[model samples]
Target: MTAGVETQASAKVSAPSASRVRVEAAAPRPNMGWIVPTLYILFLMLPIYWLVNMSFKTNTEITGTFSLWPQNPTLRNYIVIFTDPAWYSGYINSIIYVVMNTVISVAVALPAAYAFSRYRFLGDKHLFFWLLTNRMAPPAVFALPFFQLYSAFGLIDTHIAVALAHCLFNVPLAVWILEGFMSGVPKEIDETAYIDGYSFPRFFARIFVPLIASGIGVAAFFCFMFSWVELLIARTLTTTAAKPIAATMTRTVSASGMDWGVLAAAGVLTIIPGALVIYFVRNYIAKGFALGRV
Candidate 1:
């Protein structure tokens, strides 16, 4: 009887364990989880690939041939851009204004963001809303005003003009982003710095800035991209000297029809700056998105 009872207990324990093992073994593992991401990447890459392919083909081949790759690849389009002063200068002008805008926007936003995150005052909410409202208005609405304003200041056809104009939108966005990141940091850090006989500017530069470095990166990245790609305001604000690569591309449409190959090459070149910016700040952007800290 004793032996039989022991056998029964062992059987009972082993039965459930064996069943659990079987159930686990029968359970379906994740089936090709990489498929969706792979498909997504391919979808995103297809247009870029087509654009690159088109860049290598002549206008005739581009319009006539339909292929996954260029049938008769040529360097003429890229050569045209590299050799032409107007074409190359447009790229330089774009880089200048974009850099200027990013600097000004981030510099102004840092102090303003610190204020918003650390203090409370009358109309603070209203003030913040007002700043964001500037961002809310369409660029078209501001285009004429910016043109007139820059005209008044003799700032037209200048890189600084475009940079300052872009600040109208970018400053508010930078503030909003930086404020969120600043708020995530503890007030105790500020207080402790004060206790240690650190001056306001010193503490801000040395400690607070590093703490919110990712936010700055994210803000600067956005500012650079917006200033780089924005055509309407940049076009409205400049006619020739400061005209961006985007504006120059529009001129490719001539009496002989569009220079599709050259245009494709220009478009591909335009993507480079934004791609580089993303590569550098990708970590910051990822962290910001994940934690809502930036």
Candidate 2:
């Protein structure tokens, strides 16, 4: 009876200690990993914070002092932009071209990416390298050529001109991103579908497309960002009707003077669409990189 009691006592002691050790092992380490990212985020956000602060201040307050926060904030700057046809129209023009560019880049790149990933065609490597080379070429070199080309087609000063121009860079990038993701997927899945009597188009549409949906989202987001932010090409292509917000920003500096408040407000506004785009695709970005084609 005494030996049995001693054995029960030992069991209770060992169980608690094992449980404590397990709890300790499962506990997370102190998060020093976040320090760099936190600092980077702060660095990125500071300029945006300043711009937003400046947007709320009046012209006098902005010019008078360098303060982190406005003493007297005003909504007049935002009102000015929203009410004015010139200011609002610039946003509309920017949206039209950006959307058009994103759609064209994604659509064209998807097929090209599929071809590159799935097939071993003639001059495939040379063709891909050539396509990527377009992105490497200086935008300045193409400015004149783009103007001449669009002018010949009577598309100068139009959204289509800017969209087409953006595609010169974005399409290649989209194709590269998508091809990487597509290549990661197993060929066995494709073979299985073919053996199961599924046609190529139907199988691709139903099975392969869903697998790389994350990559598509990521590529689309990148296309939108590049097209939206591009200043030189958009400016060179569009004269008035489709003039981007980046070009509209130049209007703030004229012969008479510089409108700093309006400029700050416009700058703050430019960030909104990009921010929204990033937010929507943020989840896909992580997956895109993780599951990218081998």
Candidate 3:
């Protein structure tokens, strides 16, 4: 009798387990929502893939073929860019001005950002807005004035001229970005450092700067990208000696028509520096948004 009772009790327990297994199996699975984003990413990449495809083909093949890829892949387009002085110097000049602009913009913006975030002065709000207005003004508006000013100083056709001209836009953006990040840091940090006998400059350099390193990285990345790609000011401020790659690419067009393959190759090369910059600062960019400091 006891054995039969024990068997009945075991069966009761097993019944609930079997019912739960059935319930779980009957539950609805998540929908495949991921398909939309995957499709969108592929769509965005299609033009880039086409550009790369054209870069590897001869100009004649590019016009003649309807194929998705190069029919006869060749490196002659890239070879021309690397081996030619005019083509390669454009890249060197671009890098020089871009790096100079990024560094100068960031350095100047950092102190101004700190001032905006940490202190209040007369007309501070108006001053800040005025700075942003400079950024908002079209580069075309300043191109003539910049050319005339740089000409007066005998600074035309130099990398430094382009770097300084780009600063007119980039400095404001850097200040705006860095100011946002600096405001997120607590005022208590300043107080604590003062209590420990740290001077203002020393505290700011050693203590405050590290806290907002990610913000600086993000700001620098923006500065770098803007200066790298701004064709109008860079082109206007420079001629042959310091002409950027964007301006150099214009040479591909002639009375004979465009050299499609070489133009495509130049476009591909132009993407590399920006791509490398993004890769290096990607972590900082991700962190900046997460920390609400971007």
In terms of lDDT, the best-performing candidate is 3
- TM-score for all predictions? 0.88, 0.88, 0.87
lDDT tens digits by residue: candidate 1, 102-129:
9999999999999999999889999999
> For each candidate, what is the lDDT?
0.90, 0.88, 0.91
Off by over 4 Å in 1: 1-28
Q: What global local distance difference test value does model 3 have? A: 0.91
Q: Arrange candidates by TM-score, descending.
A: 1, 2, 3
Task: Give the per-residue lDDT digits (tens) of candidate 2, residues 1-294.
Answer: 547877899877754544335455454767688799999999999989999999999888888888999889898989999999889899999999999999999988988999999999999999999999988988999999999999999999999999999999999999999998888788999999999999989998999889888888888888898888889999999888998888998888767467788899999999999888878878786776553742
Which stretch of 10 consecutive residues in model 3 shows the poorest summed lDDT? 18-27
Model 1 lDDT-worst window of ten? 18-27
Task: Write the residue-wise lDDT of candidate 3 on 153-232 in tens digits.
Answer: 99999999999999999999999999988998999999999999999999989999999998998889999989998999
Count residue pairs with overlapping backbones in model 2.
4
- Report the lDDT of model 3 for residue 262: 93
